[model samples]
Target: MKQFLIFVKKECLHIWRDRRTLVILIGMPIVQIILYGFALTNEVKNSRIAVFDQSKDDATRLITDRIAASRYFNLEKNLNSYKQIGESFREGIVRMVVVFPINFQDDLLHTNHAQIQLIADASDPNTANTLANYASAIVNDYQNALNNDQKLPYNIDVQLRMLYNPELKGAYNFVPGVMALVLMLICAMMTSISIVKEKEMGTMEVILVSPLKPFRIVLAKTVPYLLVSLLNIISILLLSVYALDVPIKGSIFLLMAESTLFTITSLSLGILISNFSRTQQSAMFTSMMSLFLPTLLFSGFLFPIENMPKALQIISNIVPAKWYYIIVKAVMIKGLGITAIWKETLILMGMTLLLLGISIRNFKIRLA
Candidate 1:
């Protein structure tokens, strides 16, 4: 036990002595969390919209005023001709164009209905959809106010209540994603590189010749990173909760447990990578190619996995980040307990065991 403690202390000193590793371990997560929380977002705000009001009447003016009053849009320009609408979009001055026909007010007053055309730049589908929805909602609110206390022939109203995120804050979507990505990168990349660095420096042979067994040496090396990974988890949780106002709707203990499991899974994969790599450069390249891109692409971090092709979805199932992401979203967003995410939890556990087994086998073979 004393020897193991000495090994752990030595490994921790080695890690802390390296300024670059310390910065990447601590500083990187902080910067990434802040960047993702504030800058990268899906929610639409202050989108510039152009209006081509051919009606030029009180009703058209009133509707346009309502749109401008809404927080989602800014009335950047009023178009004189329909031709200017295309030019506005072409010049990237506006994302949406609202056109009220010549008889908009008259048709609504006499004919009980009117037509308002909404044209949006579909180049960015999500933004365009949001913009269109905002414009349509404003128009519908105006129309409802106009028809107040009057019964329509068939009124089938649908009330939409956003379940998890009522305010539709984009940070809520990305905080967990950033957590998964940061933890995975740190645990996998750092561990793999650290082990490979020892091998490259020929210190691995010295460590092997010592009384310490290979398993003990690997454990000593991993213990420091495991502690660092836990600290990273705490840092991210604090930032997400206080700095970003993202709520931990479920058990914090459950979240931490799941995070620890994922960290172990990543570390095991890293150890496996280190076994295959002969140098730090190769380990780094392998970690980036294997862990980073897969986490970013297949884990539903930046894109929806359900939207992916069938084969890609199948491939995503093998990604540890994918399961961890599901577990996080279930706990943090939906406030679901272990019962809700047990399948994903089990999957991550299975992956960890598999990776650990393979890494141990490879490590023993190398020693032999």
Candidate 2:
């Protein structure tokens, strides 16, 4: 136990002495979070929607049924009052709301015109735009049906109102993706390269000669990075909430706990990379190719995974960051609790254990 602690201390001291690396580890997440949060914008779909139907008339019911049946929207709530619209958006319950004013059918039948309002949480403008278009198309189809049956033309005007982020800032969408990307790259890339550095320096052989087992040595090497990653997580969250003006609607404790779990998962992946890599260059390239690209492509942030080909969508299930991104969005943006995210949490846990077990088994084999 003492020897293990000593190994851990030595690794910590070594990292402390490397000022540039320390700065990069601590500083890069902060920079990336701010940069990506402000600069990027993209589209998303398959969003939850709510309906505020003031008219229980047949026309309103038909319109609500059409919107709910569409693949692009899920009818999650039927709000009783106007006040629930803000509550739903703030709680992340629904992305878009469909409202039918009172006397909707009467207005359409007698006056030949009625209004339907589409209110969306425009924190992600592209999503809002797409949803509005999709919903409008559905309503338009209903109008077309009415036109075919009756002599007087029927018109249903779709009015749009954007809530939460009226300006449609990109930060609301990008911050969570940036968090997933930054942590996955920094923790995994740094860890793999650091372990490979020790191997290249021939210090690993000296450590193997110590009384500490090979697994302990590997754990010692990763401890500093795990600690650094926790710090990175804190910095990212602070910047996200303060600098980016993104709120953590869920429990902060749940977010940190999940972040820590993901950090361990990333560290385990790094350790696995170190096992195969003969040099720091190869380790870095491997981490970038394997961890970086997968996180970007499969994480469902920059691109919608549901939009991908069936095979690619299946492939995305294996990426840790994909799950982590979902978890962060649910916890940080949606203000959801563990009950909403337990499946993802369990998947991450299963992944961490599987990766750690493989890494340890390989580390033991290599040392022997």
Candidate 3:
């Protein structure tokens, strides 16, 4: 116990002295959240539009006024000719062209139905969809104003209920994901590198041959990293809740408990890697290439799992961080409980057990 405490103290001293590690461990998440919130968003505003009104009548004028007032579309160009619409789209200043057909008001008065062509640049599908919807809504509003006396049967209005994230906030999506990545980097990769450093410095040999038990030495090496990882998690949680106002709809204690599980699992894997690695560089490179890349790419952090090919998705299922990410997302965003995340919990537990068994066996083999 004394020996473990001594080793933990040494590890703390090392962390306290290193300013670069401190900044990355603490400051990175805050910067990332701000960037994600301000820079990445789905809420379209001030979308550039080109209007080609051939009608030049009261109805067309009224509809154009509504579009301008709607705030969704910015009237960047009042085209002299319909030919300009095609040129504008090609130039990329305009996303959509609102073409009011010639004699639109006359047609509306006689045939009781008028149509305006909505041409959108489908290069960016999501933007095009939003642009088309906004245009349709404007036209609908104008038509409804003209014919408010008629009431349709079975008005089925489906109000959107964005569960978890009401605003569909991108920050909420990325925050938990970043937390998972950071924890894995700190707990697993850092611990492995730290142990490998001792070996590279010829200090691990002394520690290994010392009176301290192998398990106690391993425990000591992990203790400091465990503290650092937990501290990093705390910083992230505080920043996310207070700074970003991203809520923890589920149990905070449960989140911490899951974090602890994930941390220990990662640390154990680190120990396994460090035992075999001859140098810190090798350990760092191996963890980065093997664990970090896959965790970042395949864990559904930046990419959607549904969009990934079935084979990649199946392979991703085996990655421990993928399970951890799902657990964090469910707890933080969905506010789900044990009943909701039993499957993920089981998967994470399974990964932890597999890593733990391998680590223990490998450690024994080294001692022999």
lDDT winner among the candidates? 1
How many clashes show up per model? 0, 0, 0
Worst 10 residues of 2 by lDDT: 37-46
Leading candidate by TM-score: 1
lDDT of 1 by residue, 181-295 (tens): 9988899899999888888787787788878777788888899999999999999999999999999999999999999999999999989999989878899999999999999
Per-model C-alpha lDDT, please?
0.90, 0.87, 0.82
Ten-residue segment with the worst summed lDDT in candidate 1? 359-368
- Residue 256 in model 2: lDDT: 92
- Give stretches of model 3 more than 4 Å off: 41-46, 56-75, 153-160, 364-368
Model 1 per-residue lDDT at 80: 95
- The sequence of per-residue lDDT tens digits that candidate 2 reaches over residues 1-368 is 88888988998999899999899889898888877876554434467999999999999999888888887788998989999999999999998999999999999999989999999888978778989988999998899898884544474655777754455567777887888887888788988998888778887778888888778888898898888888888898889888888889889999999998998899999999988998899999999999989999999888999999999999999999999999988988878899999999999999999999999988833443
lDDT tens string, model 3, 226-301? 8878887887888788877888999999999999999888898898888788788899888888788888888888
For candidate 1, give the lDDT.
0.90
| TM-score of structure candidate 3 | 0.86
